[model samples]
Target: MLRYLRQIEVIGVENQKKLSNSSVLVIGAGGLGSAVITYLACAGVGKIGVSDGDLVEIHNLDRQFIHAGKIGIKKSKSAEMFIKTLNPEVEIEIYDDFGKDKSLRISKYDLVVCCVDTIEDRHKINEVCFKNKKPMIHAAISGFEGELAVFDFRNSGSPCYECIYPRNIHSEKNSVVSPIAGIVGSMQALEAIKLICNFETLNHLLRMDFRYMEFIKISISKRKDCPVCSKNL
Candidate 1:
């Protein structure tokens, strides 16, 4: 604790302890996941669970920083090895599969970070978190564009990912550059750190258009028919 006291003092021991006691589930091991997990461990989040069914591809070297030089490795194992070298204080668990509600009993974690690229899994995680009343940090990137949002389902009036991105709208292919994924992934990590450290973080949908270096944020409204968070709210 003393070694990390400089950081713990600002975040506070209580919050630090809270972070140490908390575990976060990262649903991807690609670009966004690489940056998200790297910082979470650095901040001393006690346990991090990573789930990804993909193996490292050579093309991932551009931005999937965690799996560098370890292409062809399983994502979970790759991420575990990455963290083991970064911070021994942070424990990592691996799930070598996609994180569906049926496959993952997410209640095991204090929070969930959805960094997966697919809208299908995005909806799955959204529904599961809302049902279990877990705090979720969500992010997506395509091309030079990115979007981020946070949903604390247990918090009154907090909008969910589905509130902004209804299923049909998000059905488009999510094409993204490796750096774009890293940028969004890092933002996801920042959100998680803020949540765990009791630091103030964004609660609304944030959109970034790197093509013009423009950023716009709009409050996420809860839809009355939001299947994911309406009833839970």
Candidate 2:
């Protein structure tokens, strides 16, 4: 109850207890992933699971704040080390693999935060979450831009990730500026916490342009033909 300084009286004591009992799985440890992981740890989200095959590189320091001075280390391990210091009361889990390998298995978590960079993994997480009937907090970043969306398959008509990206359009690698990932990744953590804490979220997509200092939301509707959500529909 004392761990959540911000939520203490605003959400009351019982809600804080709920937060302490929840588990979340975050699927990246890069720039955006770094932000999501840090806040969730600090927020005292119990039993967090983080996965990333990336090793910290010199270039990641700009926004991957949790791994500063720990370059060349596996991101998941490095993140886990920092999380230990932030809040020991909460248990942390780490993984160094791709998100798609066992999407359904990973979806067993209470909620999923998609901080991984690639669209394929996002699509995969969306599929598994839909199949497993879990909620997904989706986030992505490139250059000075970023986007975030949430699809709680537990709810009817919630849009999946594929409702936003086409298969042909998402085949290539993406370009990312350090802070863009931070901005979007932080939002991912925010959404996940909101869901865990049972607070209202935008529940759609939010796009940000750091260069112009603007943020906007694009309404998303479930696709009846989306291969992932079609069965559930």
TM-score, one value per model: 0.92, 0.92
- Candidate 1 on 43-138: residue-level lDDT in tens? 888999998989999877888889988888898899999999999999888988754544346888888898887788889888888878888899
> Model 2 Cα displacement at 73 (Å)?
1.7
Clashes of 1: 0
Model 2 TM-score? Answer: 0.92
| Candidate-wise lDDT, in order | 0.84, 0.80
